[model samples]
Target chain A: MGEFELIRRFFDRGDRAADGVVKGIGDDCAVLAPTPGWQWLVSTDMLVEGRHFLSTVDPERLGHKALAVNLSDLAACGARPRAFFLALALPRADAKFLEGFARGLFALADAHGIALAGGDTTAGPLNVCITVMGEAPQGQVLLRSGARAGDELWVSGTLGDARLALEVFRGTHSLPGDQFVQVRRAMELPQPRLALGQALRGIASSAIDVSDGLGGDLGHVLKASGVGAEVYFNALPRSAILAGQDLMLQQQCLLAGGDDYELVFTAAPEHHEAVKDAGARTGTRVTRVGRIRTEPGLDVLDSDGAPMAVLLASFDHFKS
Target chain B: MGEFELIRRFFDRGDRAADGVVKGIGDDCAVLAPTPGWQWLVSTDMLVEGRHFLSTVDPERLGHKALAVNLSDLAACGARPRAFFLALALPRADAKFLEGFARGLFALADAHGIALAGGDTTAGPLNVCITVMGEAPQGQVLLRSGARAGDELWVSGTLGDARLALEVFRGTHSLPGDQFVQVRRAMELPQPRLALGQALRGIASSAIDVSDGLGGDLGHVLKASGVGAEVYFNALPRSAILAGQDLMLQQQCLLAGGDDYELVFTAAPEHHEAVKDAGARTGTRVTRVGRIRTEPGLDVLDSDGAPMAVLLASFDHFKS
Candidate 1:
């Protein structure tokens, strides 16, 4: 069987046509109806083997993470994911690998009621590129340029566990077996803050997903919004496992290490209760880490209100 | 500079927001308003380094072709091009390659009036993945399953030259420099039949873009429609460069060799005049090379109306 037939049997959600997808797989294009007065939210992410992931990583988690990262982008926009198209390049079409990948992909897709749309499959170096389409009411879409000076900066869920797991996998650090499992889960299966994002549509002025670390991603929001930020490193959220690590390691992972998919957003201080309520409704922990400033550059602060400096940096694909 | 910064400086269309986009780059997601009451047509195509193209190919053409292929998918669905997101992974961020690639990509985007939405840049083996979004009025979207048993199978533009060009490139055959140029353009820089596809929406019953050769793609229509087709080899359209080739080479390229990117469609025989008008309106040549049959299998007929057999097969990534 060729790539098309294989996809038809395993990956294609043909039944989606009955569930709002005007057209699903097998067509040259998948078609869906947009909610009237809603804006389509688009995000594309490419994950390459050996660079974004390891060969040792199981295919199931790989598939989940591939779609989740793109979904995180939608979450940051306060958009509800409606569908996604996956362009996958496999070194070979091993049946075992395909089964695990599709299961993990459909599992996340089913939970979100997102349809698998259309894409191409090819044989080459292993890579997964997914383009997610979501929607938000017109004028309600969150944007990075919406942040203003004096806004409180808040982040959803814990940070640094994904990066901490990476260090452990790289042999730069070691953790007990149970701790390893916790961190690995954080790295492998990120639950994007979709509910929290939707609830913060009007409450949050600007938002970004923490993919390239809290410090770097927040820098983007500040840069785009023509403002700066002062993030109190001590106020940063970390999982119990990460909190138990060395102080410097915890600081490094929380501030500079990447692959966190939590939402970092800005809200007026007056909306603090609203932010907390949204987090509570979403069942996610929210932390107030800092405030947006009128200054031109970012500043990291310690608990003593003193400037803090660190050598670690957010992941830069080209620079790295 | 980081990947995001490089992308912003070179590829981001910040001004597109003033046109129709609610939000553009530097944001977590791009927000676009789809025309109300239209179905969103989504398609994605991935081009790998070694599997899809050669390292020696020009980067400019590579970029154009990458987007063109995805656009072709939209065309097959009779969708009008709107915007596309590009997720490009590069082995290294070479300045010259990026410039040429961007120039070619933007030129095509400008010609089609399609916006570059949002995508992530990453470091990895060279690969290009593009997701194109288009729109078609609900219920007017043409589908493969719409083909009827008595429909006349039609194809837009000339074919087979692309496959002929591939053989020349592979050093398996040789052609005059002028003939080589004609065929090479067919292979490297195919013009997707977008206008024709849109025009054929109401006239054509079903359509598919010929990426994997006429036989295989036609098979998709047959399978989806639960019908069969009998293609007349002598009636297949070919460019002068391809027509002058040996009989076997002509057969192989015309029947099995891929990457044509032309649209193959089915229209009722009674709508011949309407199909012709669509072709005329779109400035594309339409050829009737086959007829859909109620039989269970595809057939190839020689000039004498006798069964013809050959050893050519459509491009299949894993098998190839």
Candidate 2:
């Protein structure tokens, strides 16, 4: 089939009324009629083979992670996803690959009620680039620069499992087959905390997605808000698989290893109850692991309340 | 420099107030406040190293064309450029390359008043994907499904020069030094018909950008509008460089050779004067090339009005 025909058969969802998308695929440009008082939130993420994902990953799971990562950006901004565009470059028109990719893509899109608005498909090496558009009330959009001193730092869902899966995949560490199931799933099919993020709109003074580990991602909020933070190492939330590992490995994955799609946010101490309520309503586990401070550096405090410094760097594509 | 630091130092424009952009760059998601009553237009295009462009291309021109092609889609829909997101997967962080790329990117961005929003930068094979957003008045956006049976087909600017340059690059044909210069420019730095497209908004019945050849692109308008076309070979406007070529070569280049970022639209006979006036106001060269028909297929007519048959075909990445 032709590329255009391939697009219609695989990517076009046909109905977009549920999401307020006036036009979808097959047009020169997609038209969106956004909520009048809401501001538009837009973010783009590109995933490359070998760099972002292993070549052995299932096409279905790869598709899910590609869109899910972009959705996480919207979640960090406390925006409701309205639609997305997928620009894919594939080596060839492999039917099995296309079918699996499409299934995984629409599954997540359906859950969020996000329409596939428009995109381009071409022949090249495997690459997936997604641009997601969302909406939030004009003045109520959560921002990274909203944090202040004395605010409680919080993270939703578990951390470190995705990194554990990566280390195992890279042969740097080994986990029992049964123990790796959940970790592998964490690395492959992460769920964007859309509900909890939206609920934290008024509660979160600052927010960011933990894609590059909690400490590094939270660093963005601190730098933008002109504040510092104190992360209690013992307070970090980790899965059974991660917690069972050695403390050193746990610290490495929790603080610096990337691919965590959880949300890390800050709220005033007075809003602690509301933050927990938001997480509860969404059925997402939320934990208070740190505190925003007026000081200028990030301090990782030991369980005994003493500063313990070690190398924990964020994933920087250029530098690393 | 790290990816984040490189982004701040090079890509971030610092001031986005002029475009009504509430937030940009450093944020997880960029916030946009579009014109209140207008509908938003969005289009995405991906360029791979050896597919859409050659590796030997100048970084500056490649940067401009990457964004320009997407702008061309917005132009086809008669939308005014507002902003765009860049998702780049670079092979490495080369300071010289980044400097030239950013300079070219910002140059076109500044001219069109389009702000750079949030994007992802990663290390991988050379690939550039751009998603551009624009705005058009409600009920006035040009669509491919609006053409009537009896309408004049019009194209803005000249055609076939880009294809000639490609042929030269492939060693299939050669041009004089001066001729090659202009043809190479056409292939490298195409000027999106922003002003002309907006001018034709009310005058044209249907429109599309000629990226995949005029015949193929107009076929989209035909299929969408349920009409046919009669392209007059003698009537197609050509650049001075193209006109000096052999007749058979000229026919092939003008019909099926792609990469021409020109606008093609159809208008009723009664609106001819208005179309001319619009072109004059925008300082764009426009020509009438054919007429829409009630028949079932595109008919290419020879110089003397006889049915012309040739091996002209549109560029399909998969089939090619």
Candidate 3:
């Protein structure tokens, strides 16, 4: 089996043609007829070897994380995924790796009801770039610039687990074998909060997925919405791995370490009930982590509500 | 400038927000509201260094060809270009190369009125992949399976120019400096037939863009349409580059040498007048190259009406 055969066997089994898709994987292009009254949302992300993932990372998990990250973008926009196109660059033709990768990719795609529409396979260093298209009602799509002063900020799921998982990978932390499996899995196979996002369509004022760490990604929402935020450090959801860490150190990791893939959104206080209803529907906990403020920059407050100063900020691909 | 700065300076110049685009560049995602009565067409292609193009090819042209090839897929479906997302993998950060590439990409994008929505950039071997989105009226998309028996086959623009240019690049052919510039330009920078495709929406029974050599790509259309074709050799458009080549050799080049982004389509005999009108409206010449037959295999005939045997075959990345 080659890459093409592997893709056909593992990833192309779904009947995408019946999903309002005029054309599917077997053509030069895929033709999609939009369901009436819905707008399309498109997002793309590229993951490169040695930069985005470790060379020895599990191929299945790599595939899952790749699609998961892009799905997170859709979640941020309050769009339900429809289909996706993948472009994979491999160093050489490896049937085993591709088979495993496709298996992992399709697992998530099927769960989200997104069909693998079209893609290109070529010879190069391993890079998986996925472009996802989703849909939502017109004028209902959430954006980063919709937040306003006095809005409440919330996050879905836990933060800093993926970052801690990386530390476990580097041997800086000694974790029990089963705990290691769970944490590493979280790092590799993140579940984008798709249901929560769809339910938040008119409820959340603004949103972004936390891929570049909470501090950096939330900073983007703040910058776009032209607002500041006051995050309560004690309210941050952290794994037990960070339970006993120094308060400031744990706060830094929660703020700066990335790969969470959780939805960070803001909503007017009047919609708090709707936010709670969305969380119940998705079976995920939504916590009030902060509030959108009129101030001009991020302010992190401790349990006692005193501002804490910090340095060694979050990851910036261009800054380093 | 770094990658982010370079992108902001060049690719972020156009404001597509006013063009019915809900979101443009520099966002977590782009939201597109589908124009009522139109379905979306999406396709993606990846070009890797040493696999797709030589390292010495002009960066500007490489960028143009990458987007144009994807646009050709949209043309094949008889859709109007709407928006595109690019994923670029580069070895190292080079501002000059990016500027030239963005300039070339935007030049064609502006001509077609397509918006640059969102994409990802990463560090790796040079790989350019573009996912293009287009739209056509509901149920009006021309698929490869729509051709019928006795349909007249047509191709837009000239053939074999890109193949001839590749020959020049390989140093196997020598030409006057002026012709060299023109041929080389054609090989590097292909103009996708977006306007012609939009006009051919209802006229062409079946269509495909000639990217994987005319013979191989046409074979796909035939397989899907469940028909064969009898192509006239002398009817094919030839350039000065093929002036002295043997008739059989030139025919093979036109048949199996790929990288020509022209549209090869079939129309019912009753729609011949309308097809011609489409060509005239788009300012592109359309030639009647062949006729679809009930028989299910390809046949090429010379002007003398004798079958022509050709040796050139389809280009496959894995096979190579």
> Residues B65-131, candidate 3, lDDT per residue (tens digit)?
8899999999888888888998887777787898788888888888888889888877777788899
Whole-model lDDT values for every prediction: 0.87, 0.90, 0.84
**Shift of residue A172 alpha carbon in model 1, Å:** 2.2
> What tens-digit string does per-residue lDDT give for candidate 1 at A40-86?
89999999987888998888999899999989999999998888999
Candidate closest to the true structure, highest DockQ: 2
Quality class of the docking in candidate 3, CAPRI style: medium
Residue range A223-271, candidate 2, lDDT tens digits: 8999999999999999988989998899899999779999999999999
Chain B alone, candidate 3, TM-score of 0.96
Task: Give per-model TM-scores.
Answer: 0.97, 0.98, 0.96
Please give, for residues B3-112, the per-residue lDDT of candidate 1 as tens digits. Answer: 86779777986746544666666688888888878898889999997777889888899888989998999899999898889899998888888888888888888888
Please identify which of the two predictions, 2 or 3, would achieve the higher DockQ against the true structure: 2
lDDT of 2 at B119: 85
lDDT of 3 by residue, A1-320 (tens): 45556457756665566576777776667888888899889999989887789999889888898999999999999898898998888877787887788878989988988888878887776889899999988889999999999999999988877777787777776677877787777788899999999999999999999887898888888999999999998898877766656665576568887888999999999999999999999998899999999988998888899998855266645444
Candidate 3 residue pairs that clash: none
Clashing pairs in 2: none
C-alpha lDDT of residue B312 in model 3:
42
Q: Please count the clashing residue pairs in each candidate, in the order shown.
A: 0, 0, 0
After the best TM-score superposition of candidate 1, give how far the Cα of residue B108 lies from its true spot, in angstroms. Answer: 1.4
Better of 1 and 2 by TM-score: 2
